[model samples]
Target: MRAISVIVVLAGVLSCRAATPDLRFGWNEVDYVWDSPTQRESAIKSRHFLPEHNLPLGLARWKNKLFVTVPRWKSGVVSSLNYVDIDGAKDQPLKPYPSLKDNYVEDTAKEIPSNSSIVSVFRVFVDACDRLWVMDSGLADILGSPNQITGPSIVIFDLNTDKLLHRYYLKVTDMKEDSFFANIIVDVDNATCDNAFAYIPDLGGYGVVVYSLKQDDSWRVSHHYFHFEPLAGSFNVSGIEFHWTDGVFGLALSEPRENGYRTMFFHAFASTKEFCVSTELLRNYTHIDKNEAFHDFKLLGDRGEGTQASASFYDISTNVLFYTQVNRDGIGCWNSNKPYTPENNPLLFSDAELYEFPNDLKVDDEGTLWLLTDKLPRFVYRSLDSNELNYMIYSIKTKDLIKGTPCEN
Candidate 1:
């Protein structure tokens, strides 16, 4: 009778364990592919076949279209901006933005006018108001000898109508000759698009620039936090070891508080440390130069070695920050309400084959997180395997990711 009771107790425990549902990380589906030679040739020809270099760095979505930026940093390409129709197939070709005639191959002048169009764009941001913000670095061949075609500027366009809304040039006083405006984040007023603020990170100049829509003025804010740590400069991605001194590459904005102000979280590409500052302090330009005014800038914590990130996006509804861990070949997440520690911020997904180097992350209107991965190490240090997909775009539900961690609440 005791043996029978033992067997029944074991069976009950097994049944309880079986009833528990298995938790999953998240389901990522490939939305676009840019790996085949035919695809590369097609994209190159679509852009007028200016320069053979075709590598996607930044991504944004508006309506049913996906916008991808192909920086001229490598081969001085003609069209720096391109878009893909989501309604088309995964292998659909990329079309130049605005128009193919606007991006001419012969217009390779040393200093193209910023008012003409997009000279060279490193990254782009599509706001909630259906406005696309293009961060034009205004420099060509960034990886090689950079040629300043025009001064760095922000070009705003109405995505709904496909019209140029405004073009605000960054003052020369706020930038250096080597300044590279890489990433940008737009902060809009509550329930309105007017009186917006655009924060841009000067990755090469080691500073942050704030542009006000209401004032039509801009200011450059410099802090030691923008610089990279020496020890974290070396990176090993996909078995390729490299050393980069890039500073202030990624930027993200938290949801606005009761006072209609948001917190800005940023990090250097060559460092594992994350830092943040309130937008209120940044908007007040008078005290930005003062050392005491930067007291609000706080060092969140280190993400540990081999966790350097390229881009980050914060979900307002979930209050969770999602960032791409390039070196780890996956994405990591941290709950703003919890401590920023390794235990709290776990690797949401890490795949050696699927995620070579997740370079960009953006959140869309439907609460979907989009990621763009380009095997940058292979494209730069080594030759890309044409047989394998070099560039890929993936999307996963933000709500599903939040459920994978304690941030679900």
Candidate 2:
């Protein structure tokens, strides 16, 4: 009797251990178009199921709520921002943000005051205080025409009130070129009490601009070090991530003319400092030696190689940097090896989790990375077993590299 009991207990223990999850770091899209009546019935039976939106661009998960900002363009019209919810209920559109039409003029009352000028929200973020940060990059008329309108302002909305709080304006015109605010991330606490900084990748200006929440004037605006060479008269910046721990900022450069479509690159800044110039001292403000305060830079690119799509650093855990490489024809991780690059850098993970149309890739507190793919049909999801093969969110554990070890290349 004792031997039989031991065998049963051992079997139970083995079963439990087998159920434990492992980090394979791979995923796939579960094609739901071929679902059967029974499967459809089962999905409907669960209230947690929700419809998926069109191509998703940016993603942010705060607490139990997940926000995805997807931009959709209609012919002869401005793009639209589609917000969605995850976790509690698959992917459901929370709200819709219209695209910005006019941006060149300095008229705030007609633009900011009017709800018609609000463009698609490119990125969504939540501060430590649970305040939602929405970045509306007014508009960029890529196609040359007098009818086209461009926007250069960043509008802040209070999530609790769903009302516009403060508007941060970026003074840039001649939108015919590729110059406009691209991406934004808010750092509420930066050793200087509570503050928020906006990073603007001005492709038209060929540099990165920094703005402070505490500043009310444009004279205080600062431009960081930009050593990038433009390609085909189009050297635009894409994404920006803030590194609070190291006091460094990571900025991504869009593909140059030579590189194929969607190729990506990133640069890092260290020991960043900022100051405000009041309206009274606007004329007294002097540009200081920015290089003296500069420390080091890490370049993630190859003159000729795989494409680097996007990049971002998890604000919660400042250790690792995450970037994306698009694979339309089924290509995998991006390969870049320039001087001062980490040999083991561009750490290639398995393509099992790679999406067909990858955009707006972001990492969360648990090291879990999320991407809004271009292939989400009417709906998408992941089951317990097939979850590993679909859009279901999963936790990831990465081993930190030891001292003096290569992290990228």
Give the lowest summed-lDDT range of ten residues in model 1: 20-29
Give the residue spans of candidate 2 off by over 4 A: 1-54, 76-79, 97-117, 140-150, 173-177, 190-194, 218-286, 290-304, 314-318, 327-342, 350-354, 375-409
* Per-prediction tally of clashes: 0, 18
Determine which window of 10 residues in candidate 2 has minimal summed lDDT. Answer: 271-280
Evaluate model 2: give its TM-score.
Answer: 0.54
Task: Give the alpha carbon lDDT tens digit for every residue of 301-405 in model 2.
Answer: 331333333334432233334444432211122222223233434333323233333445555556555554443321223212323222323223323211223
Q: Write the per-residue lDDT of candidate 1 for residues 220-313, one digit (tens) a residue.
A: 8888999888899998888899999899988999988878789999999889989999899889965655768767789999878778999999
lDDT for model 2 comes to 0.37
The most accurate candidate by lDDT is: 1
Please give each candidate's TM-score: 0.86, 0.54
Model 2: per-residue Cα lDDT at residue 293? 26
